[model samples]
Target: DATLLHSNGLTVLPTGTDNDITLFGPINEIAPDAGIFESDIAIRYFDGPASASCPTTTAAATLLRIEGDLIVPLGGPATSCILQGDILTVEYTDPTDASGDPNTVTDSATFDLRNGVLQSDKSVYIIGADMILTVIEPDWDRDNDGAETYDLDAIEWDSDAATVTMGNAGGEGAAFDPEPSSLRETGDSTGIFQVVIEIPNTLAGDKLERGEEVVLEYTDWGPSGADYVGDEDEDINLTIFTSNFGATVELDQKVYSWTDKVYITIVAPDHNFDSNLIDEIGNSAEDPIKVATRGTDIDPYKLVETGTDTGIFTGEVILTGFTAHDADGDGVEGDASGTTAGVGPTDGFLAADDDDGITVSFEFSEDETVVGSALIRWNIGEVQWLEASYPATGTGVVRVVDPDMNLNPEAVDNFDTDVWSDSDAGGIDLTVTETNEATGIFEGTVFFTVTDESSGHRLRVAEGDTVTAEYEDNTLPDPYTTADELDITGTSIIGTIVPPLERAPASGIRVVDAFGNSLGEISVDQQVQITSDLANGQDRAQAFAYLVQVQDDNGVTVSLAWITGSLTAGQSFSPALSWIPDAPGTYTATAFVWESVDNPTALSPPVKTTVNVI
Candidate 1:
């Protein structure tokens, strides 16, 4: 029986030869039930010509006739329907019948025929009588597909390309490195790709404890084969700021004494967290991180006495296992005279049979000890006992022996050597007094006499050998408070001496103290600049008194030189400019105003401005 094809297929070649044509079989084969006609007839097919020659026999057609709905068989009923040998037609049956399933409608003679099919085996011009069918799978739903979420670290990222690779979960933990083609191509679109990175809580537990930064880098390569070379790679950095769960300790001062209580605090950056997240020991468990603060014990140490009269006393205290001292003891001295009766030692021991004559010991009160000295070690006993003392009397020398006598063993007078006298012992002479009054005013004078014991005459001490005067309440004033008062002020400039060709000239200022007191005066050599047009020093000086300047409190330059010669206070000076500028060069003219060099001498900064004599 001839098959009833649904659709047509064709092949058009340059020459309609037998081998140039293609063929397809009938697709809509049918079977029916009764006169009512039910058929497995969801069939569809393609139709085309069979050969290159014109149809000489029966003309092929996709027949659709039914015989009682059982077997609807049809084929080409005519022969020699003239057609061009080079033209073969193709047609299709049914809109969505790509698979040609045949289980639905019934077949009948009135059914539609899509097109003709062809066969080329015999070259008899069999046109459009054949059909073919194939099966296809159902479409898939992409949205409901299952996917696994992964952490940042769990994904393998190629640092070189700055890309993240997906990994398999609940398997061997294998990573899926996608090909470059898998990345979405960017062009007329915003080509931005992002990945979520989660930081681990265990890392940076001390600084953050709760917060961590999972550094993430992303890069993108431009499209390949673009019109022009592009700087396509892009880098993106992300940071997550978080809090720290730890303790902090601060101190009032760097050095702490043993008597002071060490202060500390224990707190977290955030107080609220699940209890399970807090770490207790080694910070492993708990919700929030736990913090503890402690301080070190300071050891109290005494000030060690280490020098003679008029010397320094050194001391130290250990704090937090660190050693610090009062800037190493220097310029130290001691006086054994004070507490001599209790702490001073004698010459030597005298045995039984010796009558070494009477030995008298001199002593002083603890309050009479010198300021920079101490009376220590009267006897080598438990305390090694020492006491701080100051100079009570005005500048006097205390001697260890008698005066006006040659009592030494080798003296011309040949006096006893055991006893202390002018010839045998040297004396310490003091001549200064200090007052600890709050006003810093000390009223005292030093008196001393140089005598020639043998001539019974008084020796003359040089005028400058000793000075006795009441220094009054002289002290350096506070720099900050006094600086802003009615005092001498000026400016400074970088000057150049043309005649000498010096890099910088001597430019200075003159100033005076609060009480019209002058600072040290400097009288340096001055020079003039020469203009190239003028011969030697012949050019007339054009004084620009209008071009002067001053500085404000914030050190900003301001035009305060309206009255050029007048600065702050009564100090003023004239800048003399008489010589001509022989060359085209720059020169600075400085005006200085200073006070007399008596008492507190004051100097002012130079107020100067450069003039280009061209």
Candidate 2:
């Protein structure tokens, strides 16, 4: 006689063998009306064969009747029965559900079963009409002023089938269908059903109050097809809280010139605690607002705290040392200035001040929405003091006039214009008439005119006042030669008496006449001389001359005269080449001296003397 045994107490089974079972029973019992005398036995049925030794079933149990002659074999049937287990307690407990507004709410439940024959591993199920979820917090109102309530109209059940359904009832929603594929025997009666319920975003409130809670109540079905005896319904409690806030930054002006006085004002409206503006740190004193700027044309400068008004803090900053060259010439400099104001101390805004000449105080409006007008002014006195002296020419007429209506002459006098005044003559107006042929002195006539200071009208000077004009040769060193004018028949000569042979052993030639000087008129053939003493050790030198016809702006030159020869070193030679021009025009006679006629290594630099051919 075979006996049904508990799956957990299966030590009675044969060990180390397949323990295959063969049942031979009567097809029909002799007792005619007894309904074939079938004896139903409880046994474990695995969807597939048990992996462990026979008799130790890893699957749930099913009832099988033994009345007819039947043969049971492995791998032939999808379901097979092993030994049964003693009945044990099965219950559901620990349901949890939570949500944050605008987000999904997740609900879960657990089934606890102990010491029982779990006939169907898929015993856990949720009742559609039994799940009740509600918002517990009275102040958790989102849609209306009344109490906020959440119904389980939209519910999602986590199972092998992953079934979802909708209901109109308060919390009575969809039922969870068992997933057979997910069923497996756990130690002959110990198994758990974990139910995951999801409330979609559609049901979640568009807005939710902070510090609110939700309660979920649901009944779970176990193997007996009844509500869990100990805990008829599982209750899940969940709380919600705030997660995020808002902040913003604004500015007064988008663009500013380097010299513009920018007004920066920072206002934090959100910082208003109670009726007054105060940060979380509790300091009511105008919050130290930091204003920073970033751009390409700006020099580094510090944003110093100038003062404050109302809840807005004020700071001054100057954009100095503009590197942009003003290529567009818009008068207003072109450079991008990006200013960002944040809540912080002034330490972060301080940088090494370059103190460039350009500076202006800037103020920003509260809320950074309006920028104050920028008044940029120059430090004229400081700038003029640092500037270099003005360059002056030997002879030029100076006319004084006031461009600005400000009658004060301080602006003009600051440029050292008074240095040109004649102390003895009261006021002097001199003109250059002619130059002396022998002494090379400039002769000029001088007169005087006085101006009525208030009306700026001219007046005659006192009769006996004599304004004598004198001259001094403050001629700075100039490269000679390259005469400005030359005569057709006149001789153009450039001479060098001494040579710096040690520094430049190789010789070079240059014109001795000052730039723009006339070489005299040339009516006929003219002689051009280049004279230079050769170095002491030089053996010989070669001289070359060319009369080049000056071209117009198109730069065309024609050789009028070409001469080349050799000369002895350490001796001065006058290479007086006769240049007879074919036409009267501006021409340059250039002379070159080389080491020798054949070798032609340069002994002197080329000298060009201009001649005017009439």
Candidate 3:
């Protein structure tokens, strides 16, 4: 092996590029419509790459530069500062390319140093775009020879028609206007340049479809003259919705104009019912049908009572089931019974046909037993079907007829049904109601009971007294306190009637003056102070104090204001000087005097007065 001389070898080489240094000069500028000292531009590495030094000619390099201007300074310059409104033209180029390359392209950038720095707060960073340059120059002359002049250039300009769209892009009155630019320079790097551009409102853009524009106007309201700059240009983006125009659309069709009950339906692929009744429709189907009647008719699924001289009466409901399907190829049907099918007053038993769909109905009668506001609700449940057996060998029989085996398994279907009326039925809630029997005024007070919806506890509310109806309190039957009430002098109750009804007493607030006179008109800027034990933190007493300032047809506060405080029992308070009018004029002040204390229902009269202010 030693005799075999291996002479086939290779050598390595070092081939890499060196880093490069470059010159970076940023230019900052300001917008022409600068309300104050505003910078209108930003400096960025728009296109060129950073500088680089390479051992060879093939290396990456770039030059960093900036361009912009400065406009109106809100405040005057520091003391002794010579102000010059003449446009400042500052441009410089580094003699050597910072990329360390002998052959490199030159890039230009503008700079505005009116605010001492090359950048301004109003700088807008456009990721990729041409450089926009500007500089603020004072309208002053150093020579002071009675003649002052400065040269400048116009950077940008445009003109176009204002476009207005009625709706959005696809809506009405959509049009476009040509936006053009016009710019001119008075002198090269010396004099001031003026550019006149016009931006039309009707431009093409998704956001602009609603409303957008670049408005140009002369800040000085006086007639346009040759010496002044055109009104500042403004860019505003806006959006308006169809609903803002009073357009309305409904998502659901089941609407109640007056009072009709509505029920939802679900079905399987075919009109046939599921053997397991798994397709039966009801509460389990997850579609709770909303009542269509708008209070005029019997509440949906609720038993309502009809009034008659013979006494109170009750009514019942008759039910029928139907089937439907999904026309699309989604394999899902909207109308189908799930779990339970077929019906006969049995709970969970739906009248559904195995081949198609079955229907069943039940009639109820009105009777005195079903007195005022009472009803029985029912909700159908689910049904299940039996499955066929597997191999016959598992049953100890390999051939012949296996007693435990299912023959023609496909031919036989098993289903279960349990149907009946439940007071707490999950679906199809029903209510029965009748008119109050006891009429005519009562001699004294009537007692009643208010039971809680949750705990079933009873609380007594006097006649005319207000009480809150809440589900947490077992008052679910009366969703709103409006539905929960006790019969004052009637044998029949307005709400769900239970034993031991409670009574409620009426209460409210009122107002009066110190001399027992009704407060007429309280003057403007007048403070009506109410001092009494009632102001000593009584929970039942509620007092409001305010001053009404007189206003002219122009909506200016022209008169003194009126003030009011608490008014209860025989207690009294006095009035003091109120608010000072912003403008001098003759105006009337009105004070509304009232209390929501012991007398919770009564409202006090308003007091008004006229005052003259210089």
Q: What's the TM for model 3?
A: 0.19
Residue runs of model 3 more than 4 Å from their true location after superposition: 1-458, 461-466, 472-540, 552-554, 558-565, 569-585, 592-609, 612-614
**Model 2 segments more than 4 A misplaced:** 1-231, 246-614
Model 3, C-alpha of 174: deviation from truth (Å): 78
Give lDDT for model 3: 0.23
lDDT against the true structure, per candidate, is 0.22, 0.28, 0.23
> Candidate 3's residue-wise lDDT over 300-402, tens digit each?
2221112211111122222122134321113444322222222211222222211221111111111101111212121111111111111111110011111
Residues 46-152 of candidate 2: C-alpha lDDT, one tens digit per residue:
32243332333323232222223333333233333221232323233325424432433344433232222212112221111111222222111222322222333
Error of 2 at 362 (Å): 26
What tens-digit string does per-residue lDDT give for candidate 1 at 1-614? Answer: 22333223122323433431223323443455332422232221212233333233332233433223322124533222222122333343444454765334333332121111111122111011111110010111111223222122222323221233332331211222222212221222222212312222222122222332323332222222221112233343333233333322222233222111112222222332222233111112232111111222111111212322211223221111111211001222110011111111111111110001111111111111111111100010010001111122112221111111111112222111111122212312222211221111112222223332211111123211222111111111233221121211111111111231111112332232333333232122222321111111111111122122323334444223221222222222333322333444444434432222231122333355444434
How much is the lDDT of residue 326 in candidate 1? 12
List per-candidate RMSD values in Å. Answer: 33.2, 26.7, 37.7
How badly does each model clash, as a count of residue pairs? 66, 32, 121
